[model samples]
Target chain A: MEAQTIVQPEKKKSNQDVIIIKHLNKSFGSNKVLVDFNINLEKDENLVVMGKSGSGKSVLIKCIIGLLEPDSGTIEIFGRNIPDLDRNELDEIRAKVGFLFQGNALYDSMTVRQNLEFPLRRHWMNVNQPEVNKLVQEALDDVGLKHTINMMPAELSGGMRKRIALARTLILKPEIILYDEPTTGLDPGTAKEIIELIVAIQKKYRSSSLIISHDMNCVRLAADRVVMLIDGRCYAEGTYDSLKKSGDPKIKDLIE
Target chain B: MALPVKTTDFLQETGGISVFTGRFFKEAFKPRYEISEFLRQCFVIGYRSLPLIGLTGFIMGLVLTMQLRPSLIEYGVESQLPAMVGIAIVREIGPVITALIFAGKIGSSIGAELGSMKVTEQIDAMEVSGTNPFKYLVVTRVAASTLMLPILVMISDAISLFGSYIGVNINGITSFPLFYTQVFNNLGFSDVLPAFVKSFFFGFAVGIISCYKGFYSNKGTEGVGQSANSSVVISSITIFVIDLIAVQITNVLNLN
Candidate 1:
């Protein structure tokens, strides 16, 4: 297929919109992964993007976070396109965004406290040790993992590791958080607890979140709005209940 | 005619590593350097590799001295053993052997560590936490390796000389002062400087190539293993290539 390229106009700062992805297209060789994909994440919104494996959900999130460069598109955060920003500008934008990976992505060599303290030290260089300790304690307390501060990631159970990862992300006091399969490998009980924790954090922080997940339980529990990704585009967008009630075979196929 | 697939792959990989090295240079000089992380990496890459490097150096020196003893005795040059062994170790064998061992241990570890971090999305998490993953991870590691290798080579050379001293005393008694005096008297500035200078390149090769392999790692757990394996292979090869270049440069400059 011939590729079409279009430059998007710069977006204005919007109090409601935390992130905006417009005409996002990413291809590896001839295999197009995201074609004209668009989405908006509103402030204080828990927006879940759901898709089957290899459906480009992860790519979309990566694009938003500037981890992956889209072939032609604009990912707007704070009125700036992510792909167009310089390192300093991008870093500034990133200070307000947090990301959680499927594998928990804890710094394996570091203790839990160090992991949580990493972002603070990186982003806020002037932060004192006492403040760092307090923030780390608070972040761990948010995830109910404060007791595991001195323990290495290798010693933590999968659930505990996930919690630590969450705490690390939360330590930055981000305005937006992105989660990629946060409960993919956990037991049902653990998954439920993680989903509940995600919900609680969203409410407590009032931060917008973009969660990429396929777990129906996660969708039901954590997503206030759901975007169905299919064939490199957003096939449908609605509240979780509305999408669940749809009679469309594609939607049914997904929920089932 | 189309090139062989392997040749094309090799070319592509070389180009990628060059670009990665270029990026390392660009990010390395930017502000907000990761000082603590760099120091941590130095400790991990330098101090931690000491025991293995020391053991290898000792064995290399002893083996070389013992092997050369018979030849020297036959030539009626047995008394010159200390000078010959010192020159050989300082000029070539010490740097090359220590670098090879470094490639095996540090290269593989850095590759696997960063590769697993990439696959698990920790690197992405770092980026999202307002940190430059390249600066915080790659630049620190590359710089640490580049800086620490020379010190390591110096230490290894000293240890190797001690080993040679011990080997000298094994059958015939050579006073410690006499052995060290002979070693020092025979070694010139040219001999020591080139080898010392080349070690930085060896360390850079190991650092950059391994980080390149790991930073772009894909596929999953299997990819992590491949990154670790190929990092050592490529870094070992690159170390030899750099050594050859250093030798040529030294020769042209009449430094050898």
Candidate 2:
């Protein structure tokens, strides 16, 4: 029951690319993190990017969110270059792109319910309170944490915190979700449950995702297509099986 | 490497802070204000600090009055004790002391809170969730400190004056009404207005410095401690610096 074999038939054109990065280049004081990198994320697809530690996986996600500026490249989300957009414009696009951090980045001071409400309050100021409560509950229920809404992030276990963070991301109804190391710190069983939830949410919302992870279980289960990042560039890209079966030592080193 | 390079680096750091301040200005005025969060911060930074500020103010006034009594008695000016202490406390000591206490308490709290958020990626998560963490966290907290410090200082001044009256009574029989009359008789617009005006700046300085330190914190767990420690140190120094400039301006304007 390989997870890659369960992916459905694709239906998309070149114009349906939700995210496209062309010749991306980023450097930090001679530490070149990305160079001559290009990637396209299609609509309604789960694309997992696998890289070793310090291999620029998180940097790529930050560039997409406009948190990091690339030196010489265009990251076009719905055909708008991320680096060229001003802060306000970047904020506008950020509403459409949800990012799940590795650490579950929930606000420590806020309750789970308040965390979910924050996105709605920011983007849809005119929406009334009843509607907000409804949406907040809906997002929480989606992650099976509706009962924990009133709890502070500290009160929740590690896995619950991660789910709460996911619920916060989902509350915005984003068209694309970017996950960074989605299963890094959790127990194996908890990590598998999170992987299942990731897939379930993607199917339920029909949202495309760009997941950056080194966890093989997550990549194997959640990826419709896998991209290998090595030397700050996309070393290979294909279905998990195609790369897993390849003779490239690097790919073998990763998937095997 | 070189002296010029070191100077340039310092300039670059200053420019970065300037840009961050500009961003706060730009984002704070836009629509979708976090009124509730702002109020919450007011409660946290202002209401919660009441006891500490009050305690310090009382002690400051009592000690100053006790120490000044021997010298005043020797000069045959013991009767002017209330007037002198009232003018000194209202005009300078009260606000500056209250702000230093605030920088110690609220400044460190903000720095540590936001620095922890930064290290754990909560700030980035907020940005991705379409929420302006600056508005929700930085602007609200800064605005609260800027607006609340003056109020806190006013309360501290009143409490301090009461403590001074008690201190005066400890040495001799100065009735409450008489003591209050002496205090009010010597106070004028010049004594009160400038101190109130300068308090706003003190609050904003502490708020912004702490936010700046925390927002740009780096490394990991160690960075959180550094942010908190530096925030207090910088904010304390900034309060004194602001007080110096404020005193100079007031003196030149004949507001002393």
Candidate 3:
């Protein structure tokens, strides 16, 4: 199971929190997704929110990124409340935050080079062509996909597409990255490669991460801490090993 | 005393579209414009559509002339054929027909593209990466459509007239100069200006409605097709509605 060496020191007293979600609540009609859920993303570590299907993990990330507004509570990123910020204000904060979608939502019609260049050219309008080329090349190199620069997303394999999508996210050199199931829909081997890449990128950039994943292997390999999401609430919070060792029935059910 | 549930749903839908439109305009005029993306969209939306529009326009003029010839000959006013057909094609038929074709082609493309992007989270990716998806996606598309459709209509009108000239020569001897002279003589500033003005509205209508349908498309894989279908239906209806209003305005202004 490769379990023993996966846990990190729970040094809660020192790390600065990069993201704070307090009393978060969201509902669609009668379907309550998140109810008074709370968690903090500490600086320079991966915080994984572990949940099963339909457990509102995606909704929580969307709320953090201001894609979906929560019914109540505050999502503060770097001290600014996301929902309360104006478009310009939110956009400014977003420049420092990158999000990787679960499905690797790369632009289908665009080439890998163009997809990587999208965020760079979009946020900084005055950037010239040479600079854009450098950034694109570097981002592609980071994901070990430099040869795919001209290839369209459709031409890439699932794993290659995921790498390209990550390259696109990395082009901006964001300080924080939110990953929505970065390893979902991958073969175990491919998933392990993705987890390693995630960890490598996080270390290279020194970026804080809030990841939503159901794969315990992924949580073990990438998460510095794990938050268990059960029935729209934060049921438990600790390192992977701590959660696995818990005597509580719900936490035990998930870990076992 | 209260409005029906369907009525309330209709109002909410209208309000959602209005808000979306307003947000589009607000972001459209802001800084950090995506020039390359805009130009690329123009190439895709405008240039790629030219051949189809030209062929359709040619057929429209030829068939219309052929159909009207029998009636004109019955009244012994067959000599007036070029002028009558020119007016019909220039002032209403060409613009509306080209727009309908554009709606079917470009409108559906935009809807399907954006809808898939929405479902897949590319739009959200853009937002999280500090790019305004509304600005980068919606504004560029709407502006390109607004600008390109008029040019397409003008080209289509010219091609349609050429087709009509060929139709005229099929059964009678008429020089190109004489046929074209007759067309231009009947087409005054009143005819050209109103038609030209309305093409912009039609373009804007198609772009906005398609974007609205696509941008908010939901319910997963099925929604992509629904978005494209609904985009065509709504944009088609909107072009006609805009045409109706433009006609009334032209009448009131004594332009026809």
- Candidate 2 wrongly placed segments (more than 4 Å): A1-15, B4-15, B30-32
Models ranked on DockQ: 3, 1, 2
Residue pairs with backbone overlap in model 3: none
For model 2 the local lDDT of residue B64 reads: 88
Question: Alpha carbon lDDT of residue A198, candidate 3?
Answer: 93
Give interface RMSD for all predictions: 1.2, 1.4, 1.3
Clashes of 2: 0
Q: After superposition, how far is residue B60 of candidate 3 from its true place, in Å?
A: 1.2
The predicted structure with the larger DockQ, 1 or 3, is 3
- Estimate the lDDT of model 2: 0.89
For candidate 1, give the lDDT of residue A2: 23
Worst 10 residues of 1 chain A by lDDT: A1-10
Which candidate ranks first by DockQ, i.e. highest? Answer: 3
Could you give the DockQ of candidate 1?
0.68
Error of 3 at B114 (Å): 1.0
Residues B9-91, candidate 2, lDDT per residue (tens digit)?
Answer: 76876687688889889988997788988999999999999999999999999998999999999999999999999999999
lDDT of 3 at A133: 93
